[model samples]
Target chain A: MNPKDTSTGTLSYEQAGVNYDLIDPLKVAAQRAAAATGANLAAHGFTEVPASRGESAYVVDVGPFYLASIVECLGTKTLVADDMQKLTGKSYYDSIAQDTIAMAVNDLITVGATPLVVQAYWSAGGSDWFGDAQRSQALVAGWKRACDTCGVAWGGGETPALAGIVEAGRIDLAASCTGLVNPKERLSVGDKLAAGDAIVLLASSGIHANGLSLARKLVERLPQGYLTKLPDGTTYGEALLAPTVLYSPVTEALYKAGITPHYCANITGHGWRKLLRHPATLTYRIDKVPPVTPVLRFMQEHAKQDDREAYSTLNMGAGFALFVRAQDAQRTVEVAQAAGVAALVAGRVEAGPKQLLIEPLGIRFGDDDLQLR
Target chain B: MNPKDTSTGTLSYEQAGVNYDLIDPLKVAAQRAAAATGANLAAHGFTEVPASRGESAYVVDVGPFYLASIVECLGTKTLVADDMQKLTGKSYYDSIAQDTIAMAVNDLITVGATPLVVQAYWSAGGSDWFGDAQRSQALVAGWKRACDTCGVAWGGGETPALAGIVEAGRIDLAASCTGLVNPKERLSVGDKLAAGDAIVLLASSGIHANGLSLARKLVERLPQGYLTKLPDGTTYGEALLAPTVLYSPVTEALYKAGITPHYCANITGHGWRKLLRHPATLTYRIDKVPPVTPVLRFMQEHAKQDDREAYSTLNMGAGFALFVRAQDAQRTVEVAQAAGVAALVAGRVEAGPKQLLIEPLGIRFGDDDLQLR
Candidate 1:
């Protein structure tokens, strides 16, 4: 019934009000336009690392080392917490803080840069949004806990009370980070992505900070709102607001074990399709798809979304991906396990057109869908 | 005659809905909590610069070099642009972009760090907001122009369409930058702010990304809306939207001339009260207060504000303040002028309690007004 008319003839992300077709092109144009200003760095005695313009973070060559920085927002996930807070007397901002930091440090670590500092930007629609003492204390505790989890300092942040720019009762949360990729050789920008490379996927802690807008849209149709019980006996809102898995530990473990990833992708925004984010003429064929968590399945069934649409829009199971040499695949999974994260060799690269083929679902996404270039 | 009466019986910034009493303590508490997590950075071989926790930027001591990073928002200035767009068919996002970048890079340069790269976070309430191609193009062009003006690379940015969390049809613009302070001696954290240190005031174009909530409230009482002409013959909105002066050039000039400043303050949200943001117990005495710009005077007069509240809330005239030794004050102004920015010897630091004294206006702001610590 959706306008996109997928193979299932049911629903699509485009119909869910997220028109990636319009947004991706704008991002591409913005990147191209912004790249022209790279020459300005020369005046400050720093040069932008070549080909780092379109990555999750921008890396700049600062003489002896490279600094990677990124500014990311937590999206509408906090709205879910706010909704649940009204239904249940508990505050979920503690978990939301972890989700916020996870979104930033995950992208920061994807380039092998160890995050040094993380800054918070909490914009409340009204000053009264912080009147709840429990919520405020929980947010502070959780932000500090998340920073401790990732081995990054909790850098100071700006809390602006933006009365009219943001929604009256809700808060808009965002953060930016600076990480260091020293020795320069550790910088990963997908130059090593090639045929025969093995793709290893790290497990996600349920829906990790992506597709919340579409998920929130689906929540509106729920018969019981935030009180809806899921198959696992927990409330749906509680399950969806679970703290995200921090990936910097896995990355640090990999570095400790001397396993250098050729390419790394933070499984956010674009879902599992982020595995093929590298710019290379190779087919990424997934032989084994990870099991979907209960929260994801509940939202998928209720939203009337099929495998193709859901997998392409949310992190079905995979939270992060690493493409490394074929021999390093098993060891990479071992390092992830040592760091308390579950991971496995899920796919391989083949000499062919740029595509992502899912064997279990019989879904194939072409390069046209990934217009990051 | 009006609400929230002080002894002077005049309008106050607190009446305009921004209560620093609540917001300042929360910030102080958040900083205190975030500092406990700084020990996490030590594991990554990076240490937090002592006492840098509460500064404008969080500085990291990375062995041979020090890095300063900051995340600042453009405040409610964009709301003015949105309102102006409806009143007139023209978009003012271009100037808004400069204001956003100025908010970021200005903070970066305050620590004597040369801004190396700037990353933008432009989150719109809906995807359809970009349907207006002219407005989107203007924003991108303006962003790049501002980055160019600051002599920093326009590193990649995240343009997330955050529906429901942000106000519909509006965008929340903020940016983060990482700057390097090489030689380490270039770092300035008020340690060099002696009692006899002279203050060099840099002229502001108008209100630069602060006090827009009060300014907008004033606009409502206007007889002619955006077309309301001020004494300078320019409309109130037009003058307020003037591009912010990029202070990176001045900082760069100072760096080139080897005239390290004792302290620097970006006169933003807290206005001239920010001049005494340093922790030292010294009075910042302004014997030669700068002339009030036309746009600011209009906001004060029409809003029925006294000189004390006006100078304490808006920039009035001074955009930035640099405290240096009395001998280097003239050369600092000369260097600022060489960079094409207007500067003047506005004040001096005196041995007294922590306060800001506008002697010319017969007003004094105690340490209670500036409470980031």
Candidate 2:
């Protein structure tokens, strides 16, 4: 049960073959090249929000309003859903749809934008994949239902059978969301993130689509694979396939309450390290942390990762975080509850060297750990 | 050289393992589900343009302007680029970037929207695929160059390593474009499309990223594979990997010249059948057709497809089509030419049934040939 027990864990995201060292430079080079093209928006009467280049979503100034756009894939979570379907005889695509939608819409809301339209990208390896009417219909029903839940129009999408590129019998799911930042002043690109800001953490529903690659790697070692039961009496597959929390409603409720977060982090691929995602030289000090869910706990123990590696590489318990004025922390939590999402004041932002300190777990992430820009 | 010789080939797209019958229905089902979620847009002060549901791009009524968005993938074209790279000792990713960008941005402009920002999605089977710095940098340089050429900002993008979904050593390329359909009067979802409009056909640059699955299937039958040369002495892979034309500038130029097309069709996927894609019951009579490019001609000769199949499946020569009043035909051609795109008056829209007729080639496509909704 302790992360300090490293004897059993050898799992890290990099060891799962998704090394940031190889991937991050490409992103940094891309950001530099992307920065040069910002002026191109002027031709269409839209100007690029200079600081939005490396943010969760790309924001553009469209005269009276700022529009944000993001494209995100659900990663390998659907593979888990597929594997579970084989064991349980149930198509979990309804939740797969929610996870896919949340991955993109959640990132869009990080910049204080409310998503208006979402388009689906479903690329399958072969046409036979759709011949299974149950799975296909479940996907369709789920996509529409998720879009409705997020309050975004189910805009047109492309369904291509990419035979030779994508592996056979599998489908790759991704979504693109376009949102509006009305009133202009609501656009939060970390410009207002400063010292003494309160940090509100939102509870996640299991892994929530991140760290699935590492989680999938861990499954191979288990004697029973996805069918193995955790202490909670649920199969490992059921816990790992839990749907992601859609945070758009929480951001909407906060907006309605007239509380604009100085910055928000959609805790995704980079884990808690995302808390320092904004390019600000400040310390993120945490006094408390959420309890580890059963699935993540099972995965952490089986993978044999220490506290530092688990907290920085996986969401652990907090799926999302919002930085606000000190007095607004409790209000942010209440607003999330009104929208049916649980939240807590997990930490505070302080004027210090750039880093994150999870005091309860004794884990620290330095400024050099993340290099998005 | 005649397309009537179908005896030598059984290489239809369906036989190549990409069946439209199996794929299109899922799209239709998804579209129906998507339609139910259009009401969600109203919550963000945006209304869904009803007729836009089945169009190439999704349009939203944003008061002073209509916004259009589209997501499209290059579809195994990068596989061709990869094979060609292995043979030629050079990466054609610069052109690959253009093809990927064109797939989405061109579709966005079909609704008379000018692209404002384009985000890239480069997903590979593993991280090692990006280790080839030469190939990766070429892709980055090409993406930036294409965005600059289209007068759109290069908004942020996602590059994930999808281990088991995408095939190893291969990358899937796609883009999501958000564009502005300014003045509201410029938005064209075929409401104004009618008889007596001229059809201006714009020439294509080789295959332009479509029909590659069939094209790739043809490669296996060749003794030398990708290095095999055509009648023009260019290698089969070289011609197939040519960059797709960027038509955003043409749309922008037409708007500047005070000419609003009744409707426009980006000739992709369904080939000449796309001429009748507007859902209007009218006959598109093609008096003359652009000369088929060498690569497509080679593919037709090798694949032995009849004229009807060739015209109905591949772009053949025309890359884009614009439907405007007959009087504006010459001006449209001149405008496209001024923007450096070769275009000519190839046909006329006539009152009749829903179909497209290539008079010169004696090829015809019924309305049932394509069903996007």
lDDT of each: 0.84, 0.88
State the local distance difference test value for candidate 2.
0.88
Stretches of candidate 1 exceeding 4 Å from the true structure: A1-9, B1-9
User: Which candidate should be chosen as best, given TM-score against the real structure?
Assistant: 2
Candidate 1 lDDT over A124-238, as tens digits, reads: 8877777777898889889988988888887888888888888888888888989999768888987877899999999998887887866666676777877799998998899
Evaluated on CA atoms against the true complex, candidate 1 attains a DockQ of 0.74
lDDT of 1 by residue, B162-212 (tens): 777788888888999888888799999767778999999999999888888
Query: iRMS for model 1?
Result: 1.3
Fnat of model 1, as a fraction: 0.73
lDDT of 2 at B296: 94
Q: What is the DockQ of each candidate?
A: 0.74, 0.82
User: Lowest-lDDT window of 10 residues in candidate 1 chain B?
Assistant: B1-10
- TM per candidate comes to 0.96, 0.97
Give the alpha carbon lDDT tens digit for every residue of A163-244 in model 2: 8889998888999999889878889999999998999999998999999988888887788999999999999999998889
Native interface contacts kept by each candidate, as a fraction: 0.73, 0.81
